[model samples]
Structures are given as structure tokens and as C-alpha cells.
Target: MSDQIKVKLPDGSVKEVSKGTTALDIAKGISPRLADAALAAKVAPLPHNGDQPEARLVDLTRPLEEDSELKLLTDRDPEALEVYRHSSAHLLAAAVLDLFPETKLGHGPSTENGFFYDFYRQTPFTPEDLEKIEKRMQELVKEDVPYAREFLPREESLERFKTEGDFMKCHFIEQFTKPDEKISIYKTGKFLDFCRGPHIPSTGKIKAFKLLNIAGAYWLGDEKNPQLQRIYGTSFFSKKDMDEYFAKLEEAKKRDHRVLGKQLDLFSIQELAGPGLIFWHPKGGIIRKEMEDWMREEYLKRGYSLVVTPHVARTDLWKISGHTGYYKQNFFTPMELDDAEYMLKPMNCPGHVLIYRDQLRSYRDLPMRLGEMGTVYRYERSGVMHGLLRVRGFTQDDAHIFCTPSQIEDEISGCIDFAISVLHTYGFNEFKVELSEWDPNDRKSFIGTDEQWNLAQGSLKKVLDARGIPYKSMPGEAAFYGPKIDVKLVDAIGRLWQLSTVQFDFTLPQRFELEYVGEDGKRHQPLMVHRALYGSIERFFGVLIEHYAGAFPVWLSPVQTVLVPIGEKHLEYANKVGDVLKAKGIRVEVDGRNEKMNAKIREHALQKVPFILVVGDKEAEATSVNVRTRGKDKTETVPLDSFVERIEKLIAEKKPTLD
Candidate 1:
């Protein structure tokens, strides 16, 4: 029998260690500096399968029970941040218990943005109480309490939680742990809580942290359950990074689409008109028209047929499409007619499927692309709505391609190219692509066969590699039907927004029973490719407003040029100049009000008009006007005819600048 286990390092080296030796001993043997800096350890069992097992972080003191691959974690690693935040959450709980001895603890974990701890108390936590809690947390940090880990039988843990009157923790212990299992618990000073953790060495390691805010969150996120206080906060490795994070957050707030939308007078959501529905004013409508025009032109240029579909479909249709049963939560209440139940369309896919099956198609007409600006309605939770980004009703610039198996690769490639064109045309210079693939280990979560999944994933990877585009592969992120590619655009402040997706489907085609006759005299199922470049028009427009800060390009601006009269007498000349510009198909507005030239200029500039044409005695006599372009104070005087010609060329070329 072997007394030692062979541990493989990531550097292709192996070390024989005693079977019960812990990861901390291995680190110290390697280097004392590493031992001091190590926060956690990751291990992979030997003889790994194609399924990449999720890496788990464990305490450095955890002992190795078998042969495995070891990876020591440090502060620079992203995974270590989770451990740090979890430790911070513990500090928060300890502080809360010290300040309010009657408070009971709920689960606290690390979020993508930060960490939040939930607490159940008879009375709500006031703002002043939060300040005191924060101060108490700082004191605990100064104390440098050690996080002591221990385990107890499941029954004992439940009994302890029950004795302490922690109903939530008792419920969790009963649900998650088996009777015979040992439950892990961590103790810090007077606080004791159940958890599965790999915390930092001590509380002092948490150097930079701040409590953000407190909100009433339902226990377990269920409205029916008693409410609990959720305190959100963020932590970083250093104070400088935390400061920079706050600075960037402030910059992002300045570019918020909701604020910009109001200031720009672009659109609104009227209370009488109902929530989640948009009312685009004249200025917003002009931009929408331009966007739609460009999209339709591209559809025709790319050999896609423009089709219109109904706004509602029969409930039977949704059942056949498999959405009625699985996606009932997102659908609105159905309307029952005399004969059947009609549902508002939550997606445009089923409509396109009906169109494809309208006629018997042959292999020659296999790759049929149907495009539409389909509007859809969905039921979104009230608290989740955030302006246009998370509205309940929006127009989708959607398309579906029905093609043969042999043509799937080309169709996918074409979709990717089209998405790139969308980014380029919309002035988005940076983007990231993510390929979501099925998890083979979790086969029941998916609907397709292993062969079909393999083929579709290979095709997606091949297309991305052919274009030399880098993408992240996210296992288990795919829909139940098939794999997908989500494209996120990098905004002005470097935050990413998911705006485009190209997905493959095997279940829908099968469910719809769609078929096309092949050249071999056999009927075969057609593959389906669903792609939405702008996901939704309202959301895309919101992103655009934030991207450009309401100053649209020449082709998209509602009032491309404004004619300002320096004095009331110059109104005639301004009208003449406006007429000349309008003749060239440029959108121009004349400002003939009796206001100062500087005031008029300032007002137009504030409106973000691309160009301001000032006509005064100097230019009215000579039949010239002074042009004040946006973002610049200098004025260039030119003849009225010459100025009209310049704007005509600029608008015709669809220039993004006024110059």
C-alpha cells in the first residue's frame, strides 16, 4: 500500500506527500512567501473527464485526501476576491450581532458587484443604525479576530439555530444537509453562523471596504416571506482601486440613459398611456425612422424577405412551440375569445416558424431568411424595470434563417458579419463575444442529442476561429435547445451591454415539424438560425443616447441645422436660408425669436443641434451666414449658397460630424 500521494503541480512537476498533509504545508515547503500570501487552494482530481469540473476554492488548511492537481491562490487572482468578500461578510455579521444581540442572521455571500448580508430583526434598521453598524465593523477589523471553523452533526446544527431563534438558518440547515452529514460552521467572537467557506486568514486582511446602502429584501427573495434588511457593500485589495471604482461609477451615472433621455427630450413613459410602453416624441421618432430605414435597406441588400406577422397568436400555437409550458412566467395573461385563448406575442420566433411552413419548400430555396421589426410584450417584475433597458414592451429587430445542415456554417458566418456591420455603423468601436455551449454533464438540462450538440458547438467554434475573433466559452449558459453567441458592446465608460445574439435551435424545428425536400428525393428537417442584432429598438436607442450623450450624427439628428437670426430684421434672411437648406433635403429650423445671438446659440447648443447658422446685418446684406458647429465656439462665415451646399454634402454622406 502507498503511504504517500502524488500531487501534480500546474508546472508539470509532481511531489510525493503524506496522504494527510494539508495544502498549507505544501505552500510552505515551496516558499515561505507563498505560504504567507496564499489565500486559498484549488484542486482537480486526476484522470479528468472532458467535462471540466467546476474549480472549488478550499481553505489552505484543508488536507489532500487523494492524488490531484494543485493551484495556490493569491490576492491578484479574481477567485480570491470571493474569499475576501465572504470574509468581509463574516465581519459584517459579527459586527451586527455585537451591536444588536437580538438580530438573527441569514445567508450572506459575495455578489458580482460586492457582498450583501441579510439580517432578520423585529425592528427595521434605521440610517443612523447603519452608520453605527459600519463603525462597529471597523472596530472588529481593528481587533483582528480569527475565523475559527468547526463542524457539527446536522441535527445538532439545526437545534442550535432553533435555540437561537434563527428560523431562516434552521430552514436552510434542514433543507440542504442530510441527517447523517456534518454541517460546517464558522465562529468569529460572539457570532456563530453556518457556511461553506474559504475565508481570508483574519479580519485585518480586509483593508478596503464601505457599506453602500440598506434595502428591505424579502427573506429568500419571496414577497410572502417576512422582510429582512439587506446591506450592500464592496471591497477591493487596495484603497486606490476602491477609489477608482467609485470614480468610474460616478462617470457611469453621468451617462445614464434615463437621465439623458429626459434632458434631451427624446422620449417618455406616460402614466395614462400605461407603464413599460414608450411614447417617442418628434425628436425621438426621427431617430427611430432613420434606424428602421437603415435596417430595412440592409435586409433587402442581404437577400432577406421583409415579412409582417400578427401581434397575438392562439394559445395552442404557444403550446406547440413549447413556450406555454416552460415560459409561462414571462407571458402576459391570455385573452379568452369565444372559441379559444389568444396570447400576446412574447417572442417573434413562432410567427416566423409558421411563415416557413406556409409552403412546401425545396432544397434550392432552403436558406429562406425572414426579417421583421416585430413588437413583443412581456411581464417583467416591478422592481426590476430600469427605463428602456428593462421595459415590458419593445420592438425587436429580429430575423430567422431556415437552411439545410450543409449551409448552417455559412448562415452563422453571415450573421456574425452582419452583427459586426451593426457595431461599425452605430459607432461602437469595441465589443466582446461570448459563445455559450451546453454542459454535457448536465444533459437533462438540455433537449438535444449529444451528436447534435457536438456538431453545433463545433460549427460555432469554427466560425469564430476562422474570423480570428476571440470569445469566452461559457458552459451551461446556452438555452435548453442549443448553443448561442452573445455580443456585448463596450460603452463610452467601458461598461459592457449585451445587445446582440445569434443562436441555433434544434428543438424548435423538431417541435414545429418543419421540413424541406432535398435533392436526393428525401424530406429532411431544416436547421434554424435565430439572430437579433439590436435585440430591441428601444433599448438600442437608449444605449445610443448614452453613447453619444444626445448629440446624434447628421443622419440621425432631428434638427440637423438651426438658422438663428441675430436680430428680428434678419428673420427674413434666416427664412430664406432655411428654405434653401430645406430644398437640399436637410432638416433645418429657423429661430426668428427676438433674443440675443449668444442666447440663441447657447440654447441650440444645449439642444445638441449639429450646426447653428447665425444670420445678422453683416451676413444678411452680403447674403452669407456664420456657422457655429457643436463642441466648438469659433464661428466660420460663408455665403448662404455655399453653406447650404456644405450641409447638403454632409447630410448626403451621412457624416458623423458637423465639420
Candidate 2:
């Protein structure tokens, strides 16, 4: 064994220290301030055979015996936040044990926004109990108890947990570790359990935390098992950050598409029709028509040939596409036909592939853009469905581009432009993109040869760089078939929604042996790109509802102009105005309900009519109207002809605002 080891810091400097020097010792050697700020350390040990070291989180106080590169993580680092939240979960479990000693603990892990722990107790935890548990948590934090990690023989650990009636912990230990191997456990104050943790130094580091709510969850997510109390909570580095998160949570609740869908009367999911299926009501149908028409027009303008495909195909077709072998889990059950078996198509790739291979094509037709508003049906777990976002059936604005290697980059660039236009035209200007690249180390998770993957990834990166578009690289997020680019749009209240995708599939083209004749009269396999601007019509509509809070722009509004007459005397003039709008292809309606003018205006406002034109006796005689735009308190009067011209321009431009 070496007496001294060289430890490399993030800044390329190395320190010759004793072999067992811990990360905390290194931090304190540098400065007490660095030691104080750090929550955990990410270390990559020097590999013995020249292989790259795998970076993993470790306790700051854990020993660094070998030559390793170390990074001390603080709140500023995104990874440290995850460890902080995980430690907060430990704090929550400690508090729960302190208040109710008999309750057994389950797994507590950090979620996307927060942390949750499942507990089994004979008595259900109530709102008041949550308050008490939170108070106890504060007390535990004040005590500054350390999260002490220990290793014990697996048999001994299981015996101890069994003595405490912690069957869940015992099960986890048996499932995750061999009986002969040592088991890792974490202890905080009097509470101790089985865990592998790189927790913060102590409970004191968990500064700001709130226990949000409680719900019931089955053990291991299996309903057949006993139910447990799942307590949800979130923690932040500062009180201000926590408060801002709560405020954002409130805003998200207000903008929930399910609630907005009801208020706008845009869509519904009926019980009779079963779950995970959408029912587009009349108003919603009109909005969908506008969306489809706009997309189809763009397809033609961009030189794409629109085509249609069937909803179902023979199971043999899916088998040929490798969908049955690779994607059978997402497929609906196969139906027994007289001649052969059939299945609902989960994707439009094979259908498009069949079209591409239907006729022999020369080099002049090398780049064929086949587009569709193709409806696909797939199986969705009953519990996972959430309104339009997760559905059993959906129409995709799906398109496939079959181009030669030289033309692949240009095709991707065109797809990106179309995707951006879709977002911008729908009123979302702020967006972030991600390129999902496969992990070369885990080659089993992805397909294609090294050269093919390199060429595809390089082309995508080149197009993004040429366009000067900013995107985050997400390694290992790529699909099994190939790499992809996902565009997530920021909504009105600052929620990110994933809508558009441009994916490269090297597997499907090869599976179908797709080819086009080259200039040399040789059959060459064409590179296939599958892109969906509006990934799914249903999901996009849901995002649109939440993005605009159901107050769609003039071009998307079902009833664009509503004529509200003040009295019966102005009813004739209101009808005439409606006639003019209808002739211009504007969606117009006259609200002649036997109600007060104010009542009519209030109703129309609730419906989110873009323009509510009030016609009274004087206004009708003068051929002018009072316009009350949605979200404004006051109404302005304008000449009828001028109003028509202004609205036509707004609709033509698809302005995000009436102004």
C-alpha cells in the first residue's frame, strides 16, 4: 500500500496527503469557509487499469484513500440540492419516529420538486399530526444531530430491524444486498434504519422545510400490499426560496389545464367513453380545426407531401418493424383476425416506412418529407392517466424525412424551424432545448453502429451550432433507437412543458431496408428522421390551455367576436354585425339572451371571448361599437369598419394580445 496519495482538486492541482485522508480534511486544509459551505463531495477514484473513474456522491467526512479527483458540492451546485432534500427526508423520518415511536418506516426519496416518505401505522395521520411532526422536526434540527453512517453484517442488520418490526427495511435489505455482504445503515439521533446515504453533515443544515400534505400509497406501489401514509414535504436553502416555490405552486394550481378546460368548455373526458380518451366538444373542435389547418398549410409551404395511414395494421407488420419485439409493452392487446392477428398501432413509423418503400425512387426524389395528422392508440396504465397529457389515443403532427447523408443536416434544420414556429405562433416565446445523446458505455440501452451514432449526433450538433441555438446536452436520455432533441416551452406562470421533438431513428430504416437509387445507380439506405412539432394534438391543446389560461388568441378563439346588444332596440344591428363577421370567415355570435347588458357581458367574459362588442342605440346608429377586450376593465368604442379591419389583421398575424 502506498504511504502517500495524490489527490487532484477540481482546479487541476494535486495534494500529496496520507492515504486515508477524508474529503472534509482536504476541505478544512484549504479553508474553513469551503468546509462550511460544502454539503457532500463528488469523488472519482483513479482506476487501476486506465479506465475512467465513475463519479459518485460520498459523505464529506468519508475517507478518500486513493488518488481521486474531488468536487465539494454546495447549494450552488444542482446535485447538492438533491442531497439536501434527501437529508431533509431523514429529518422528516426522525421527527415521525420521535412523535410516534411505533410507526415503521418505508423508503424516503427525493422527488423532482421535493421529498416523500411512506410510513405504516395502525392509526392514519391527520392534518394536526402533520403539524405536530413538523414541529418535532424543527426541534430535531435545533439539536444538530449528526447523520452517522455505519456498516454491519447483513444478518445482524436484518435481525435488528426485525426486532423493531421494520419488515419494509428488512425486505429492502434482502432485496438490495446479499446476506453475506455488509449492509449500510444511517442513524440520526435515536432513529436508525437501513440506508445508503451521502447525507448532509447534520439536521442543522436543513434550514427551511415544510411538510405539505399526506396521502395514502401502497407498499412498493403494489395495491395488493398494505397501505401506508405518504407524507410529502419540500426543503430549500433559504426561506425566500421556499416561499417562492409555494407561490409558484399556487400559480400552477390556478393554471391547471383540467380546471381551465371546464371553464373554457374546450374539452372533456366522459366516464361512459372510458379513461385516457378525449372528447373534443364543439368549441374545442373548432380550435383543433384551426390548429390542424395551420399545420397542414405549413406542410405544403415547406414542401412536405401530406399523407394518411390506417389506425391499425397486422401484427406481422409490427413484427417486421421490430415494434413487437422492442415495443410490445406499450402496445394494445392483439386482436385475433380470421387470417392473422392485428394490433392498434402505437406509432406511425412503420406506416411511413411502408409508404417510403412502396415505389422505387431515384436520386432526384432522395428527400421525401411524408407528414400526417396520424391518430395512434397505445396502452396506458390506468393510474397514470392525467387528462390530455397522458392518453390512450392521440393524433400526432408526425412527419418523417428520408434524405441522403448529405441532406440530413438541412432536413433537421428545417424541422427545428417548424418546431420553433409552432411554439411562437402558439404564444410561447421562452423555450429551452435538450439534446438526448446515448451513453457509449451502456451500449445496450441504444442501437446503431459507432459510425452511425457519431454521424447522426454530429449532424444534429452542427445544425444547432450553425443556427446558434442554445441547448443542454443530456447524456443517456436518448431513446433506445437513437438520439433526439426535445423542446420545452415555458408557460405563462413559468412552468416548463415538453411539446416538440425531433428524433433520429437509425434502427427502423435498417429494419425495413429502406433505400433510394443514387446518381451512380446504386441502392443506398436513406437516413430517416422522425420529427413531431406538436408531439401530440391532445397534449399540445392541454399545454395551450394552461399557457394562455384558456384565453386563446383571436385566431384560436372558437367564438372570436361576440355581439352583445344593450337592449332589444339594438338587436337588429347586432345581427347585422354578426352577418358581416360571418361573411369574412370570422367566428361570431350574437348573445341575445333576455338578460341585462352587464349580465351578458359578464357571461361572455367568463367564456373568455376575445372581443365582446356591445351595440347600443347610439352606437348602432353611428355604425360604431364598444369593444371590451378580455382581461381589461374598460371598454373602448371604435367605428365598425375599423374594428373589422383591426381584428382581421390581429387574426392574420396571430397576435398574443389584442393590442
Candidate 3:
């Protein structure tokens, strides 16, 4: 055995360190300050996977067993936060065992929002119990117990968990590990858990934590197994950080789309109508019409042929498209019609395929783009629905491009450019693009031949690279058919929402045997590109609402402008001003109600109208009006003619805001 292994640092310096040397020792060798601030280390193998490292976090005291690239994490590193929070979850489990030793353990993971630990016990935890658990966690932190890692054979681990009545742990051990393999486990005080860990050094490393709430979750996320009690909690590096996190959460709750939807009287999902369905009210409908109009104009400008598809199709059509075999879970149960079983269309791809096959086309007719605001239905699991984000039925801004293999790259580039334009027009300044590729090792999870996957993925990558767009390449994230690119926009609150998707499909064309006449006088298979910029109008609208906190821009507001008359006599002048604005293609509504000017201004402000024009004796005599803008404390008086021109320009530009 070699006495030392070569360790590479970020500065391109290599040093020979003795085998089993801890990361903390390496940090100390680098600098005292580095050692003091170090929290964890990320290690990567020599060759790495792709351009980035296949890295995993490990304790600062954990030993490196092989030649590798190593990165020491400090307090300022974002990854340190994940390790800190995960250790907090371990602290929670340790504390729970101290208080209730009989509680059987399940898995605990660090979620995006926080951390949660599941426990299987006869009695459900209550509010007071959560508080007690939190207190005990604090005590454990003060005691400063070390988190020790140990390994056991998979069979031995399963038997241990089973003997302790930890059925969930036993199931996980059997599911994720082979019978003869060694499984890793972490022990903190009396509590032990099977985990793939990158935990912090000790319990004392977690400074601030709180148990938030309790909820029931099925074991292994399957209802067939007994339900387990999940204890949710959050932790931060410091008390100030924790407080800020809680404050941001409170602010987010205030701007929640569900609450704002009810307050603004925009949309609803009626209990009687059904779950996962949307009913756009008059206010919301107005906004929808505006959105549809913009999309239609863009379609014409971009040379897309708008087409409509039926709401339902025969089972035979789905069978022909292979949707019956592959996408059956998301489809609605079949309905027995007069002669055959029909189903509400779950995807627009099959319908568009039928349209393509309805006619024969020459090579000159290639690269044809078909666009629609098509509505489709899907069966979402009952617990997974979240307002408009996840729904049973929704309208998609869908389009499919049929083109020869030679034209695939340009078509994909066009879709990406179009997606970027959509984000910019909607005031989104930041976005992330992901290139999802199939995993060749996981053959059963993906379809199509290796050649087809290689070609499609290469095209997608080339398009992104040619455009100078940086994207994260995610293996095993591709759709069943082929590779895809998904675009996520970062909103004002720094939250990401998936909006646009451009997918390259290999199965649909082969299933339907779609073809176009080639210049060589032979029929050739045409490639299919499925893209949706606004995934769904409902979902996009919901995100926009939260993005702006219900204060929509001038072009998207349901009521663009409201005219408030100061007195009953001035109502005539207000109507005249509104008429002139409306003549210029602006959406203006006159507030002719018999109320005080202040009251009218406040009401319109609450409705988030972009501009409020108040006409009184002073403004009426001068042929002008007082403008009260939303979110502005003071009002400005401007000429009626000037206001019309300003609003006209805003509408013409489709500007997101008046400013």
C-alpha cells in the first residue's frame, strides 16, 4: 500500500498527504483562519463526471481515502448551510429519543425550505409536543454530542431495524441497498439512523433551530404502508438569520396567490365543479383575453399556424400515439360513449400528431409550426395539487414544430430565443436553463434507440452552446420520449418557477409513422419539437400575480384606468375624459358612483388600477385631471390630452409598467 496519496487544491497545487488524513488537518495546514472557519469539505474524484465534479459533502474531520480534488467549505459557503441544517435534523432526532425513547425512526432529509424527521409512533405528536421536542433539541446542542458514523451489512441493518420495530427504516434499507452490501449509519447519543450522510461535525455546531409543525406522511410515500408522523423544523447559522428566514416566510404568506385570488375576486376552483379545475371570474377573464390577444398576435408575427383541437378523443387514437401505454396514469379514466371508450385528452401532442398525419406533405412544407392555446386534462394525485401550479385541467400555450433532421438545430434555437423574449417582455430579468438528457445506464427509464438519443441530445446541446447560453446538464431528467430544455424564471422574491419547455421527441414520430417527402424522392421521418412557453396560462398568471404582489402592469391590469369624479356634477367631465381615452384603444372605466373623491381613489387603488384620473371643478374647467397612481402617496395633475398620449404609448409598447 502507498504511504501517501496526491491531494489537489483549488489553486492547482498538489501535496502528498498521508492516507486517512482528515480534511480538517488539510485545512489547518493551509491556514489557521481557514481551519477556524471550515465547516465541511466537498471531494471530487480525479476524472470527474462531465465538466463539474460529482461532489459530496463530508465532515471536516472525515478522512479522504483516495487521490481527489478537495474543497473546504466555510461559514460563507452556501453548501455549509445545508450541512448545518441537516445536522439540526439529527439534533432533533436525538432530542426526541431522549424524551421518548420508544419512538421508531424513519428518514430525515434537508428540504429546500427546511428539514424534517419522520417517526413512527402510536400517538400523534401535538403542538405542545413539538415545543417540548424543540426544547430538548436545544439541550442536546448544549451538551455537544458527537455524530459518529458506522457501517453494517445490509441484512444485519434490516434485522436490527426490524427487531426495534422500525419498519420504515427496514423498508428503506432493503429498498436502497443490496443484501450483501454495507450500509452507512449515523449515531447521535442514543438515536441512530441509516443515511447517506454528509453531516456536520457535532451537535454543538448547530446554533439556531426550531421545530415548526407536525404532519402525517405515508411510509415510503405509499399509502399502503402505515402513516408516519413527520416533524418539520428549520435552522440557521445564527439567530438573526433564523429570524430573517421566519420574517420572509411571513411576508410570503401575506402575498400568497391563494389569499390574493380570493381578495381580488379573480378566480376560483369551486368544490361542486370539481378539484384541480379553475373558474376564471369576470376580472380574471378580462386578463385572460388580453393574454390570448397578445399570444395570437405573436403567433402571426412568428409565422405559426394557429389550430384548434378537440377536447376529447377516442381510445384508439391514444393507443396509436402510445399514450395509452406510457401516459395512462395521468389520463382520465375512460368514458364509455355510444360505440367506444373515449377519454378527455391528457396531452396535446397526440392531437397535434393526428392533425399532421391528416395530410401528406412534401419536403418544401417542412419546419411547419402549429400553435394553440389548447386545454388538456390530467389526473394529479389528490395531495399534490397546489392552486394553479398543479391542476387537473388547464390551458397550455402549446406548439409543435415538424421539421426534417437538418432543420432541428435551427428550430430549437428559434424556440430558445422565443422563450427568452417571453421572459424579458414579462419583466423577468433573471432565468436558468436546464438541458435534460437521458441516462444510458438506466435503459428502462428511457425509450428510443441510442442513436436517436445521441442525435437529439447533441442537437439540443449545440443549439444552447451556439447561442452562448449556459445551462445545467441534468442526466436522468429527460422526458420518456427524448431530451428537453426547461426554462425557469426567478421572480422578485428570488423564487424560481418553471415556465417554458422545449422538448425533442423521438417516440411520437416513430409511433405515428409521420413522414415528409424528401428531395431524394424518398419518404423520410420528420423530427418533432414540442414546446410550451407559458406551460399554462393559469399557472403563469398565478406566478405573475405573486411576482408583482397583485399590482399588475399597465398592459395586463384588468382595469387599466379608472376615472373618479370629485362630485356628482363633475361625473360628466369624468365620463368625457374616459370616452376620449377609450377612443384611443385604452381600457378605461368611469367611477360614476356617488361617493367622496378620497373614497373612490382608495377603492381604485385597492383594485390596483394603474392610473386613477380624478376630475373636479378645477380640473374640469382646465380640461385636465388629477392622476393618482397606484402605490404613490401624492397625486399629480396633467392635461387630459397628454395623459391619453402617455397611456397610448404604454399600450403600444406592451410595457410591463407605466414607469
Find the candidate with the highest TM-score and give its number.
3
Model 1, span 1-659: residue lDDT tens: 88789888889899999998888899999999999888788887766556555566888888888887889888889988989888888899999999999999998899876799999998988889889988998898899887878999998999989998999999888888888999999888899988878887778778899889998989888889999999888888889979988998997787787887888888998888777888898889999999999999999999999999999989888898888766899999999999899999999999999999988889999799999999999999878878889888999999999999999999999999999999878878899999999998996678889998988899899999999999999989998888999999997777788999999988888999999999998999999999999989999999988888788888889999999987788898889988888888888999887778889888889899998988889998899989888888688998888877787777766776677
Candidate 1 residue runs with Cα over 4 Å from true position: 1-34, 46-53, 440-445, 620-625, 638-659
RMSD of each: 2.6, 2.8, 1.9
Tell me the tens digit of each residue's lDDT in model 3 across 420-488.
988988889899999999999988788899999999999999998988999998989998898999999
Candidate 3 C-alpha error for residue 206, in Å: 1.6
Candidates' lDDT values, in order?
Answer: 0.88, 0.91, 0.88
Judging by lDDT against the true structure, name the best candidate. 2
Question: Candidate 3 has what TM-score?
Answer: 0.96
Clashing pairs in 2: none
- Tens-digit lDDT string for candidate 2 (288-375): 9999999999999999999999998899998887767667888999999999999888999889999999998777996899999999
Clashes of each: 0, 0, 0
TM-score of each: 0.93, 0.92, 0.96
Q: Which 10 residues in a row give candidate 2 its minimum summed lDDT?
A: 319-328
Q: lDDT: which is higher, 2 or 3?
A: 2
User: How do all the candidates rank in terms of TM-score, highest first?
Assistant: 3, 1, 2
